[model samples]
Target: MLSDIRPAIVSTILFTVLLGLVYPLAITGVAKLAFPYQAEGSLVRDSAGHVVGSALLAQPFAKDEYLHPRPSAAGNGYDPTSSGGSNYGPLSADLAKRIKGDAAALRQSTGHVQIPDDAITTSASGLDPDISPQYALLQVDRIAKARGAAADEVRALIQRNIQSPLFGFIGQPRVNVLMTNRALDLALPKGQPKRA
Candidate 1:
């Protein structure tokens, strides 16, 4: 029994040191070396070089002039630490009530009777940074009106920011809302302040 126990203890310690310590350290080192920007949380910066946000996370943009991300259930919107959806299943009265409310708001703002589901629903992660291209285009007119810019110019801005499917077909075409808003701010006429 003593001999068998000794081998088991040795193996346990060996694996603990190898997998619990060495493996994580080695992988972290490789990641830090290979993708320094991403290793630091993929933060985005403003033109003046101040850190604005992480490209990987979504932010709440409530202004009409800025495009919005899908509804978020994480701590009043975009709290990475509490990332999760409402968890309300289909046919749930609570879910229906929330969607009905959001759809009403979107219809009023976008002036469209039929808005896309994504426009009113939160993503499962509750922090998706991308919106479908269709949804982004749906807001072009509203944003243009809010900013007093021409709809065609705003459409052109959206077109310029459209990110193609990864490697030509991995995911649907989507727009990163924060990136698009930043571009709009930069292109806005002189003296216009960047919206928070």
Candidate 2:
């Protein structure tokens, strides 16, 4: 019985060291070496060299001059600590009401253009920094008008920022709103504030 129990305990310790500590450390080392940028959270920087945000997480951009990301149900909107969907089911009256309010606000802000569904819906993570191309296009006019730039120029900026689908077919094309907006800020002349 003593011999049996000793071997069992020894094996348990060996497996724990192998699987619990060594495996995790090995994988982490490999990931850090192979994908340093992503392993470090994919942070984005502004022109001033200040870290602004992470590409993996979304932040609120309510001002009309910037393209808006998905509606966040996360705490205080885009709080990474609370990243999650609203959890309201498709048939939930609360969900319908929230969508209605969001749609109404969007229509009022963007002047009755055919709003994309993504424009009004919250993403599953509530921190998706990317929005559909259609949604990005929908906001171009508003952003251009607010920034005092020509619509064509703003459209071009959006076009430039449109990220292709993974391997050209896995997911739909999307625009990283933060990157596009930062590009807009760089493209426009200094001291210009968004009008509406």
Instruction: Report the C-alpha displacement of residue 35, candidate 2, in angstroms.
Output: 3.2
Where model 1 places Cα greater than 4 Å from the true spot, the runs are none
Clashes within 3 Å, all models in order: 0, 0
RMSD of 1: 2.0
Model 2: per-residue Cα lDDT over 1-196, one tens digit each? 7779988999999999999999999989999999988988898876666778987788989887888899998887899999889989889999999989999999998886588989889888889989999899888788888878899999988999999989999998999987787788878743654321
Error of 1 at 134 (Å): 1.1
* 10 residues in a row with least lDDT, candidate 1: 187-196
Candidate 2 Cα misplacement greater than 4 A, ranges: 1-4, 189-196
Clashing pairs in 1: none
What lDDT score goes with residue 188 in model 2? 70
Q: After superposition, how far is residue 135 of candidate 2 from its true place, in Å?
A: 0.5
Residue pairs with colliding backbones in model 2 are: none
Worst 10 residues of 2 by lDDT: 187-196
- Please provide TM-scores, in order, for all candidate models, with all chains considered together: 0.90, 0.87
- Scored by CA lDDT, what does every candidate get? 0.88, 0.86
